[model samples]
Target chain A: MRFLKECKADATADLVYRVCPMHLLEPRELIKDLKQGQVLEILTDYDGALEDIPAWCAKNGQEFLGVGEDEEEDFYKLYIRKLH
Target chain B: MKRVYLDHAAATPVRREVLEAMLPYFSEFYGNPAAVYDLGAEIKEVLEEQRTQVARLIGARREEIVFTSSGAEANNLAIKGAALANQKKGRHLIVSAIEHHSVLNAARYLEKFHDFEVTFLPVDQYGLVDPQRLQKFLTPATVLVSIQHGSNEIGTIQNLAELAVVCRTQGVLFHTDAVATVGQVPVEVQTLPVDLLSLSGPALGAPKGVGALYFRDKLRLVPQIHGGIQENGRRGGTENVPAIVGLGQAAALVQGELDAKARHLSRLRDLLVAGLQERVPQVLYTGHPVQRLPGHASFCVEGIEGEALLFMLSRQGIYANTGSACASKALKTSPVLTALGIAPDVAQGSVVFTLSQDNQEDDVHYLLEQLPPAVERLRSFSPVWRKKMAAVAGA
Candidate 1:
């Protein structure tokens, strides 16, 4: 697990995205509204996005903070910090 | 947690009898039917016996049955294989708009890759392909007509006898993908006048990866998979002996107990449908009320998301399907629903309950008790529901 030290320090995200399974385009569109230095947390039930979001963050020039799991099975919490 | 499973159309639990029948093939009787030995001959005899059993279920000759890996493969072989083989006779084909993706994609593939012309015949609101509408599409060049025996999502059983008669009158070969109907409904090839039929084993209580294609005597098709002279050189591959054995047992069970099983399923299905109608408001029945599959109960609520409702139901230990998972990449709304002229918004709430002989009235009662609140809770998060409620309040 990627421990979210940066997210622990920040404690608050500027935006929250409830990602729909197989429909990541919606969340990708939502992320474009976030400003630089703002933290965005994505909560998703899709098993695939647990591996997908960090790579997407890196490619888009965003900081990959880490991920967290919710109490629900297969539901995940991912944190990303916008760079530009 | 009390679990209620109502997705029999997508798949069903492999019956105990089928599993028992298949057990020996996996271990003791593990011989290749192609080998030139006693073991092979014995295994081959059993395989042919199973074929006879399956053929009996559909009122067909044992020689006419060709084993396939799946209903999809059977459909592909039926549509593409037949069309490719008979292209010299004609290049045009007809299939219903609500056919399973296997048939639809096979037709599309032929159209795209081989310059074959395919006309997709539209269905009525209940998803029945009108014979008159189909007549308009049939030309002298139309060599084949592929229509499903029933709609998987909505559960509308077609009048295959009437449809096949139209095709026969035109001298066009008719193929019915009976994956959803064969065992559940009375599918007697002796009565239907269809040239080819497709069925998956899993749909009839056997394991997945085993299916059968019924070809009328003297009907010729170019082989889809060519290698070994298996399936009489029609489909080339090692026969799945165990799965086929399971299929045989499943078919025999269905053939013997079809009426009793159908009665049980219809009773449970009716209870669920009636319960949903009583409990849920603005629930639209999706398929033909009477002409549907005995086990199927499908509906669309006014303003809730089907995926959300399904998730909530899963949490409650009630399993059901929300349209085809194949179409989930785009949206929850099914092309089958759209073909029936259902609005996109209404189609988003589609939920199908396909019962089995095992399903009881208690399962139906449980679904009725749980589903209304689940829909209401999901509707609380739905923007469409909110808008509708607001509109109602303003009115």
Candidate 2:
């Protein structure tokens, strides 16, 4: 919540796509609408996605802004700057 | 990140020697063994030789070995095949509660499809099957008794010889899914008194897609896959020549270095277990301390999910398994751990560290150094830990 609201306020990144460990395929589809250089934030509880999202972003020519591992919430916030 | 593999029970990297032995079969000797050509005849002879080597590993005759695609398929053949073949003698079967899914599902299939009765015998807190309990279930109609030689999750090695004797005395066929124990420990078919034993090649440093089923000469099993007279008409299919060659090499290597590898694995396992106990005080050992597999060190850490622990460990390049590999993906507590009489909450935290001779003591040290912090970090986020702490504070 608070993070989603913060994501909305930033003109560069307008929305946040949420994902979990069970549904991993959603991230690619979620980021499809965004134009080049538009930032996207992903909130996920899947530990694998923390490493995977960055690698995927790099492979696809997107900028990976690194992850915020919320140790308290046991979740992660991954920011990617999409470059088509 | 520096990587360490601690999940040998699940799978292992193919050994170099095994791979080398397999290469020629894949390319040069690519002819089908069933064909009448000279190349095919040569390949067939090689396959028979490989069968002999695999048979030698467990003290079984080459003719008794049936090459299968996996341990699961081998288990299916043993359980269903035996059940179907012996239906006239008995319509009832018995299995231990903690058998792998292959055996359990095969028994269920028999019960559902062929109108057979199944009895699942319970295990003790240490996951040991009581022979007396097994005796209570055995009757004149009991056709077969299926149990695992060693549990993949809890590492509990059953008193299989005793259990096998009980089955033999009652004229019931005995089968053990020795997938987890065959290469890791000594499993002599000649002395074990079991009618059938399932083995996985991948579990023994060979390639995947190859396994073997050892059936006693006198015991009859209906062919599950009927067509060609392959595997002495017990299992039908084109032989996986490369994998079979690899399996043969792997089995021979394991048999030769059995004692040394067992000792090495035991030492590594003990060090890891002792280190974890010393570092993480709340951890509970889940398996039989002495009777378990030499390479297996399993535990249930208090107040943390096994997957979360595995994730954190994976980040540090230390990979481990939670529950049995077959059931780990489901996010359910292991039935094997539950069979050990553990609480549901504790059972959810189960982690198994299966070592092989390939792993060094330094890997265990690396794991011990990193594991406590991972557990602590995960426990901090766990609601169960908070609840327990709150109760403690209130008290």
lDDT of 2 by residue, B335-378 (tens): 88888889999888989898988899899999999999999989
For each candidate, what TM-score against the reference? 0.81, 0.81
What lDDT does each candidate get?
0.84, 0.84
Q: Residue by residue across A1-84, what tens digits does model 1's lDDT show?
A: 486533542323211212223224544656677777777676554567767877787787788788764453334668877788
Over A1-84, each residue of candidate 2 has an lDDT whose tens digit, in order, gives 112323321222211212222223445665677777777766554567767777777788777776654554444676776677
Window of ten residues with lowest summed lDDT in model 1 chain B = B324-333
Model 1, range B1-395, lDDT digits (tens) per residue? 99999888777899998999999999999999978899999999999999999999999999899999999999998998889767878899999888889999999999999999999898999999888888888998999999999888888999889999999998999999999998888899979989999999988999999999998985767678866657765778899999999999999988978888889988888888888898889899998999988998889998987877888999999999886647644664688999999999999888888898888888888999999999888888889999998999999
Give candidate 2's error at residue B120 in angstroms: 0.8
Residue pairs with backbone overlap in model 1 = none
> What's the distance in Å from true for residue B33, model 1?
0.4
Residue B349, model 1, lDDT: 89
